[model samples]
Target: MKINFALSAFLGIALFASCEKKDDPAAANRTELISEKQWILTAVTVDPALPLNGTLVTNWYAQMDECDKDDIAIFRKNGVYEFNEGASKCDPNAPQTAQTTWSFNSTETVVTVGSSSFTLVELTKDKIIDTRVHTINGINYTFTETWGIKPS
Candidate 1:
């Protein structure tokens, strides 16, 4: 009887341990999704307290030039982040390649790349939406950017 009881208890404990959850599954998915693809900017929405010519401005991507629309960013598994301007150059003097380091916050809702931090509004296998807020001259500006996986 004693042998049977000990064996049953051990089996029960082993089963319970096996069912335990490991590291956050969502975080792992986010990391994998972000690292696997090169994201290209698809849309941008900008809201500013100060009106543009006395009119509220939104959906700013329509105003972006071909060069501005060609920016691409990539995050690697090794924590290296890179941004490249496509064939066109938004600024003739701007560096073509921008390198940085990136990591997800504990909650995985924020992504920090070098000195800039972006709030992750939405993320999926093929799409990402992030937002950043800045204050300049007492005017609050919010910029929301949407990116899609670049086609191979």
Candidate 2:
């Protein structure tokens, strides 16, 4: 009788331990949202508009040429980033696409493209918000860049 009880207990524990866990993506991991997507630079704004060339600049994206404003940025799973010119090129002599490398820090709070790093203020299925803070001459300015498929 004691042997039967021991065998039953061992089998129960073994069966519970052998249960497989579901392949659920973690909430904190945002890899799925950023990889394999064609994101467009929708807008860029600087708080406390910083002085640039004697002018207080707020909308940074407006400073870009129309050709550059229509470019597409694709972040791939293989760490390669492709900047493709949709239908216009700033320079007719320049290539239609450019390639660069991109990586995220271990914490995934910041993403580095080539040598430049930007803090990720927000990232979702629909959009990505990047920010950079600078203290120039004791003045704090926050530059925010929003990228998405549509107006953000």
Candidate 3:
């Protein structure tokens, strides 16, 4: 009788342990969706076909940050975003300054902004990397950039 009881107890403990809930590892590190987060540009990698190096690249890239200490862009958790150059404040007239909503894909690695979407190839403490395949000026290209999150 004692042997049977011990076996039953062991089985019960094992069954209960097997059914215990476990946390998802990926979900724990996920960044919560929020509003008003500022994303600053760090580096940009353009398609080989695009002019992103040499004199053309330097000239256009300089124009991008002409007004500010650096080229910075802010994507608000509330759906507003600003890409400011050296300008003291974001100018609504600037081509890159616009308000838009964002959504994450099931994996939470890809973000959809307005009607366009980009894959989050990687994200780190100081940089958020993304890639978008698009056609600009009738040429298809993949645009990738690394951006830093601004301090609050």
Candidate 4:
């Protein structure tokens, strides 16, 4: 009878110790929102002055047409974005691709990868809005775009 009581008490203590309660609401929200799944860049907006001209001529002109969905630059969730890779939009002979990692800040206002950071200017139910200011050498260019979310 004493042995049975000791075993029951030990089991009860083990069960209680194993049970844990999560009390952080912000942490839960971040996990649910930012880390929920993968995202892809659906649209890109570049400075009108830069004008995808010269070497970038193709990157700009073909993407400008609203009816040209096939010619649009496609950025995958894997962090690699393809510009003029598949279609004959710009220079089919010369395709360009850029790669970078993706992450959201604590406030979910900005995303950073390497030396580049995009500030969150707006957001919608389907996408996170961002504006990117890129400085190459001494030249700076700004762009606005929306990143579409994907279900995992």
- Residue 98 in candidate 3, Cα distance off native in Å: 4.8
Per-residue lDDT for 1-152 in model 1, tens only?
01121111111100001111336464336777677477777876777633555666676666566776666777878988777776787578878877767887776778877766777777777778777765656767776777787777
Candidate ranking under TM-score, highest first, comes to: 1, 2, 3, 4
TM-score-better candidate, 1 vs 4: 1
Put down candidate 4 lDDT per residue, 1-152, tens digits, no spaces. 01121111111100000011234442333223333334444555556445333445213323443322333233335544333222333344443433334545566556554344557665443455566555545667655655565433
lDDT of 2 by residue, 22-61 (tens): 2443443465677777777777677898687789888866
lDDT of each: 0.61, 0.61, 0.43, 0.39
Clashes of each: 0, 0, 9, 2
Which ranges of candidate 3 are over 4 A from the true structure? 1-28, 33-36, 51-63, 68-86, 89-98
Per-model TM-score on C-alpha atoms: 0.75, 0.72, 0.55, 0.43
Note each model's CA RMSD in angstroms: 19.0, 20.7, 20.9, 21.4
Pairs that clash in candidate 4: 52-56, 52-57
lDDT, model 4, position 90: 39
Candidate 3 matches the true fold with a TM-score of: 0.55
Off by over 4 Å in 1: 1-28, 48-50
RMSD in Å for model 1 = 19.0
Worst-scoring 10-residue span by lDDT in model 1 = 9-18
Which residue pairs does candidate 3 place in steric collision?
A: 34-77, 35-77, 35-78, 36-76, 36-77, 67-86, 67-87, 68-85, 68-86
